[model samples]
Target: MDEIVRSNCTDRMRSYLESGCSLHYQNISNLRHLHSCERELEDYINEANAVLKKLQRLVEDAYDATLTANLSAVKVPDYSTADSKMNHEYHFTEEKQEQPADELDRDSSLVTVMILVHNMLKLDYTMQEKIVRSLSLKSSSAEIESYRLMWDLRPYVDGSVMDLAWKSCP
Candidate 1:
């Protein structure tokens, strides 16, 4: 259970007991008052449940926003400027973007979730290599590593899909 729910339940329990405490000491009362107490308790429980759901939704929305912000902070490389013809030796010269201090503070768990989501359902390793081969790029260890990174980023591009067209190509 969520901490918010726990806290709300505790508060409601305290409030309910405080409000009904006098009933315990009162002389034999009609069943109507007992029913009223039960009804009030039910209402309090319902309200607490509603608040818990709202808090959960807010937390989920905040987590999604963080994932979006972190993913967007990564720079996709420009492939048009990259040398199409793979020479004997090649190195990516594209400069990576610098992230803001606050952006860099994103939780590692969120990053792991984003990476797993992107990698899920991706093409098999062999197919990925074939795709890389078609681009006239050699399969050196370093190049393959870079392509793997590109593959990881492929599924996460938001708007302007063409911006990632070349970067995600293999």
Candidate 2:
């Protein structure tokens, strides 16, 4: 790569000097210089791309090795604590207690309507829905709604408030 780059640079410099010394047509000389610069630029770009590809591969390999080492060193969690059992039970109960079909349908309909309204308002409905779903997965709808409302109103309140609200969310 270095050899190719040096050769191209030398060729470009020689062309430039030759063009600069030409007397018949100054415009042609300038055009020759421009073409030389363009060729040099293309050569440099190709060399840079090759170097970037090698760097990218090295980074990916390093990342994979680091991840493997870290994962191998990690200790599995002990689930003997009362807190862990209670947390498991809570999630199990929540899953076991199913809502009525009508209620489920109603909730789904409401979400669809909200998404439609949000899209009409030119807000990013997909992102909003993703946020809502992610939050709801980890907490109750009331908790998610409270945070969502706070996030929605943050920009209007103050810049600091908005920043704080964003930091507070997952």
Number of the top TM-score candidate: 1
Cα shift from native, residue 21, model 1 (Å): 22
What is the C-alpha local distance difference test score of candidate 1? 0.50
Alpha-carbon RMSD, each predicted model: 25.9, 23.8
Candidate 1 lDDT, tens digit per residue, 1-170? 55765677776566656776445335346455755655664565566456555645655665777667668666553665434533422433222233353445644444444343333322333344454444322447777577667766754444343334334334
How do the predictions measure up, each by TM-score?
0.34, 0.32
Runs of candidate 2 with Cα error greater than 4 angstroms are 1-24, 75-170
Task: Report model 2's TM-score to 2 decimal places.
Answer: 0.32
lDDT of each: 0.50, 0.51
Worst 10 residues of 2 by lDDT: 117-126
Clashing pairs in 1: none
Q: Report the C-alpha lDDT of model 2 over 1-170, residue by residue, as the tens digit.
A: 65765677776566765677455577778878866765664565566456555645654564565545445434444657645676767776456535443444444444443333333322333334344445422477787677678557633234443454345334
**Candidate 1 Cα errors over 4 Å, as ranges:** 1-30, 81-101, 104-170
Alpha carbon deviation, residue 133, candidate 2 (Å): 43
**What lDDT is reached at residue 108 by model 2?**
44
